[model samples]
Target: MAATAIPSYNPSPRVEPLVQYRPLHPTFGAEATADFATITPDLVDEIKRGLAKYGVLVFRKTGLDDARHVEMSHLFGDLDDVAPFVSGLGQKNRLSSDYLFDVGNVNPDGSVMQPGTMRDLLLKCNYHFHADSAFNPRRAGISLLLAHELPPAHLGGETEFADTRSAYEDLSPDRKEEIKDWVVLNSQLQCRRNANTDKDGILDPLLDTDEFDPMKHRFGKHRLIQLHDPSGRTNLYIAAHAHHVEGMPIEEGQRKLKELLDHAGQPQYTFKVQWKDPGDLVVWDNTCVLHRSVPGGYAGKYKRDLRRTTVHDMGPQAWGLNGVGATWRSGLD
Candidate 1:
């Protein structure tokens, strides 16, 4: 007698649901609270669109490891190899890949840098408000900062961000017209020197040095204002890296830039994000915002480590930076 063969039955594949996005700020930025494992291709597209609309997107409770972080970064676009910037930070001070930009006060040996140390002094430069990779010809479209470890909220390690789009919108028509045809010259080292150099009859360098040269720094050119394509909005491009304005006197341009910066940083136009938990990822649009690290309780006493990845724009069009033939700027940060 022949026995009937039994058939194997397979259940239907589970569908990935859309994630929820709650606005964090009035003008720009949103918080995405979703399970990382459930993120699908459709959700990734939604996130890209959200980034375009909000200018900043944050993922809470991601708990992403190194591999997951890299995988998540690929959702926006191709990754930029920034290994040159990541190297020399010590073995544990950096990740295995050059793509990760380590931003922290902790040392490679799992220890915090002593206060007033050279590394600690270098971090002081971050106190100045500026966008990541603004000195690069192909500026970063999206910059991700994942909190690996954070000190107590009372310790004061907070990151502040200002909305450039809102600032541009509040500008007077005449002022907008004046800057419409203008361009800014950006220099990273020059900005760093400016912040560290002793001025106003006071010594401020983290380390003393007589050989201060601004001419030897790398520089780039960017529009005085960035016209975003998706939202059809204009955002001021002025940052700490913008040393001077093109086609204008150095002093006058600098004065105007200073004035613009002052106006843009109004309390109403800015918000502070407190990094209280690990695995919280903040993705910001560098083209439309200026961010800086607030002073922590103590550099060495507390463990505050945050890893970053600066993703280059999808080309000149992504940033509305003029034409497709734009060249990459030779700048270091």
Candidate 2:
């Protein structure tokens, strides 16, 4: 296979929105106000640009009916089915199985996926920091979560989003230069442990065997902190799946990673939306923005269901900032 020039250091680039978010519905009709497109009036070019730059965004109050959600999500990019690791609602609780991906305490059959004593530790994963599909090389670049249900008190269950693209920018040039070619490992299983912590462990959960181990069986993938090859735009691929620096010591790597993650999740680079009512759909670039839902203490309350769809990433975002890597034409259609 042909290869492009390898970047000696991770380069930095400015970030922008791939699409200019325009309202689908005008405040009023022609009689009252003016006619408008309800689905993103912005051009497809605008959306392509938006997704490349922002990594994720939301189409507010678009009124996606039962079939519309699947239709519209497909338009942005390709669609990816729910991962098998999540809970399936089975026959009785079919909503999650048919549409939404069941996360957290996904005991649809009332049979604990884990043990009874491990429930609290397990559910904490829903509150941890991570991105969708950080484990797969063909991870979803964008994930659209339409808010079908929300909490009654309506506060804690907010979806928290942090823009790593912006966070990476805030670092000094020296700092970025220092780790340009560096790659961070995204261990799929470890991430599952963080989000699916219902097992029996205090820190990052691990496989249960005779001699317990954290790094065993869980090798990592190196993802970049640079550009989205095709669009030639810069971004950050760090998330819950992100483990540590490739060559650094476990202790030092852990410390530096903690600092990066802490800065990335700070209020400044982060945004949270308290989803209320139906007809609200949100999409974000999972590669650039790490997101997690505060599933609320009301998961089984009034029954909130949100259907999510994904677009496959054209290339693994492993080369940071260098403007080097595959292109959408070579990756996304």
Candidate 3:
């Protein structure tokens, strides 16, 4: 197969480098510095190249409002809307646009969600490491998350990312070959159930009802190991949403999936980004890394108002094994 050709970008003499990157991790993450006001087609290409090299990029105090945030996301690719998921839960849109996902803990009325509530339980799933929209037929490509409002420091609203590409590179050759061609089943319901079980042992009523059965819900089928084309590296695509492996007994497949997830989640292969200011932004490629929101003292006390825009994956593996034209379907829908 021919490599996808990327057009060369040359910045003007005044701004020789469109963006500058400082490595956050030796292997994966980076802090990017760029002039937001000077955004151009050439600059967008440079940012995309940066993302290809560093799976995650942090931009400090971007100072973008909801409108600008959405506008910036368009520079990457087609955006995925949160309306389906929002409406599936029988709730009205909270953000100004469906393109912006309200990942914060605040409700439509601007009140923090109380602990043990259905919404709270559902949000708990964010604590687990997973790629955005992996449960969908077309997985997410690049995700731009901005901190609109943040809790006080040390309250633990930080976001953490796992470097699956590096983790895969470090794996024993035998282990890599063993799972290279394996297919895994990913489901949003399974992720929610696991999050609830791990946190408070609170059985979500929805999970108990037939309407929300994990087994019955639509599962996104993808290879366990895949080539992250942009970086030309093979990465483990496992996540908390990965319910089980295909062509194996349920229990056996689950245990195998857990083993891989545990290996990839080791501290050495992870980086935590602490939200500093309200306007801080983090951009990550979901095709190569797994990310999760860190829970802390800010849980039910303070509001962590974060909004995200997910770009639909345009890579060759975007559809995985699912049929073309398949859309995001949540169990709640």
lDDT of 2 by residue, 1-333 (tens): 789888798668876443345422121001011111344434344555555655555555656664666655566665665433332312244343333444434345543244323444444555667777555544666666766654464535667777777788788899787778777765554554555444564544333431223365333354556675645656656766666778888778767877778888887777666566576666666766787766555644434445576666556453232244323210011
TM-score on alpha carbons, each prediction: 0.85, 0.68, 0.93
Ranking by TM-score: 3, 1, 2
Number of backbone collisions per candidate: 1, 19, 0
Clashing pairs in 3: none
Candidate 2 residue 331 Cα shift, in angstroms, is: 25
Candidate that scores best on lDDT: 3
Which lDDT tens digits does candidate 3 get at residues 1-333? 999899999876673587899999988899999878755778778888999999999999877889888887898888999777677767877889999988889988999978898888888889988999888888899999999889998889899999999989999999988998899988988888887773666666655666656787789999989999998999899889998888889889998899988998999999999999988989999989999999999888999999999999988999999988886575743
Ranking by lDDT: 3, 1, 2
Residue 5's lDDT in candidate 2: 88
Q: 96, model 1: CA deviation in Å? A: 2.0
Off by over 4 Å in 3: 1-14, 198-202
Residues 34-149, model 1: lDDT tens digits:
67775467766776677778877778768887777777777777666655444433334346566777778877677887876666656666887887766765667788889988
lDDT of each: 0.73, 0.55, 0.88
